[model samples]
Target: MSIVVSLAVAVAVLLLMPATATLRTRSPSVLPAFVSLPSAPQLRNRLMHRLLRRQARDSRRRRSLRLVDAMVCELRAGLAPRAALLAATSTLTEPLCPRAAAAAALGGDVASALRADAASLGLPLLIGVGVCWQVSESTGAGLASGLDQLLVTARADEEVRAEVAGQLAAPRATARLLAVLPLFGLMLGSSLGVSPLGWLLGSPGGWAVLAAGVGEIAVGLWWISRMVARIERDLMGHVKGAQPR
Candidate 1:
């Protein structure tokens, strides 16, 4: 009888408790539904990755350009093609230079070595340098003149790329501004004593609204970025393909 009375009391206590109390107890086991929370860290990581990749690409491009310029100078200084190549390799910091010098010394197709290194370095412009060397070899043309023309074309292309990037900057800035405007609005509301941050963090409805806002912002930024990238890629592809043979 005592056990039965105790069981009845326990059941009454459970029934008297609020539904939200039970939910709160089980909430720890459930995955969080708020997707927009703490997104800054992820965004920061992505930005850092993009910055590092761009830096690496710019460094490679500069190195490749310098290598070509050096080879041109050496050729003009009356070095034989092999000697010029070796001198240029001496100026480079990468193992690619030594490998290319070795290939030239071995009497192999040094143009092929140049092409391989260009591909590995992600410098599409260097492919033209290899083609110039190959054409000089096949036609008995002046290698120095061919490389000088290549250097001029490369400089022109770099200038054009800079112009295009400048033209695109406005759109990129606008997209970033749009993405950040909602935060400014929230700040303004907080200044007016609306306590939006508190409400969003403290209430379930506000959480849902915050999640939707964040999802929209992410999607809009992604779409804008994708469109810009597609346009830039297409323009670059056209420019690369239009280079003089």
Candidate 2:
């Protein structure tokens, strides 16, 4: 009788705990309309990750872009690159922003800061602009045109990625559903005795079950990864003027 009561309590806890917890929790957040992004952001996430890998988020990407935009605006106002970038850092917190500002404070070049984080945008183009500025100090030949083109291309690529993320949202959510269904089954098993799960817990059969579980998890992960990589490739191809080779 005690054993049966314990099992009953365990089953009740298993079902009710998660339900009440979820119910009492804040409603899941939705993307702001300004962002109006895809619901399954994981499809755009680049890795099959564990704890720290997920946490090592680089919010600096947008900050770096903002810094560049500010630099461009200030330069168009006739400030030098060094001065413009220095002025822009007050509005940015990218890892490279402060260094750019300090270099300017020391009367050093802003091109160095641009070069340092230029790969985040396009290193070669930033360096090329630096070269142009140095060579044609007074003649504004083509520099403005190149900057305009670069910004246009960058914005277009960003839009393409947003669209791809939207397209892959359903697949990503499906993968997540597949991952959770087994857990739900496991919980149900603890109540109904339908799970031959003891065979999974105690012997050579246990090891076999563990191995099979591991393999299934790996396959599910690989499927998700392939789906994401395909989308990434397609997005890049669109940028590159060809289908993914």
Candidate 3:
């Protein structure tokens, strides 16, 4: 009779386990009930999107710089404004190049075309080129000199950005290391014959503790990201504002 009762109690506990887990998952006390971990697919998509945007941005910057250098060279070679733009753009594959060159060839508003291309292509650097073109056209200023100055300013801005990135690298690495340290702790615990995962998943109190830890990690990561973003934004804004109009 004693053995039968003990077996019945064990079975009852086993049956209640799933229900307990479900309840804990649905309403973890440390996080909002609606908050849940993102699925693998969601994470993959986000990472891909960020990579593509960075690639596109870098490509656009390179093309803009190349176009400016080419145009400056053509102008310094004694070409007319229209001929210089046509010659410079003819060497590049950027979608904006052909349209701006066509506008120059046809005696349309090349500045407007450049500006339109800059806006459509998400290339803010070209906006400065457009402005230089417009001012030179209206005031009979030296186009080559204007573009050369623009190139110098652009290179300076790039250097500042690179320096800022270098400065932030240490903080970024630190944040990443901090985020991974918990995993190291888990591994250490396992190596010592401690079932850390089992303990964390074994009871309602453990579930609450795990949820709190996850929430804290997420918050710390977000705070670091926000700080980095804010620093970059402010510095970039200051650089732009300090540039000559």
The TM-score obtained by model 3 is 0.73
Q: RMSD of each candidate?
A: 13.9, 12.5, 10.3
Residue 43 local lDDT, model 2: 24
lDDT of 3 at 95: 56
* Residue 194 lDDT (model 2): 67
Candidate 2 C-alpha error for residue 121, in Å = 9.5
Can you write out model 2's per-residue Cα lDDT over 43-132, one digit (the tens) per residue?
A: 223334543353333244445556557767887888865677677677764445454467668876655655664655433445544554
Q: What is the lDDT of residue 5 in candidate 2?
A: 62
Looking at candidate 2, what is the lDDT of residue 75?
A: 73
Which of the predicted structures, 2 or 3, would earn the higher TM-score when compared with the native?
3
- Whole-model lDDT, model 3: 0.75
> Which parts of model 3 are misplaced by more than 4 Å?
1-35, 93-99, 105-107, 199-208, 233-245
- Per-residue error (Å), model 1, residue 124: 1.3
lDDT of 1 at 68: 83
Kindly report which residue stretches of model 1 are placed more than 4 angstroms away from their true locations once superposed: 1-31, 35-38, 92-98, 105-108, 230-245
From the highest lDDT down, the ranking of the candidates is: 3, 1, 2
Tell me the lDDT of model 1 at 235.
77
How high is the CA lDDT of each candidate model? Answer: 0.74, 0.55, 0.75
- Give the top-scoring candidate (lDDT): 3
Worst 10 residues of 3 by lDDT: 18-27
| TM-score top scorer | 1
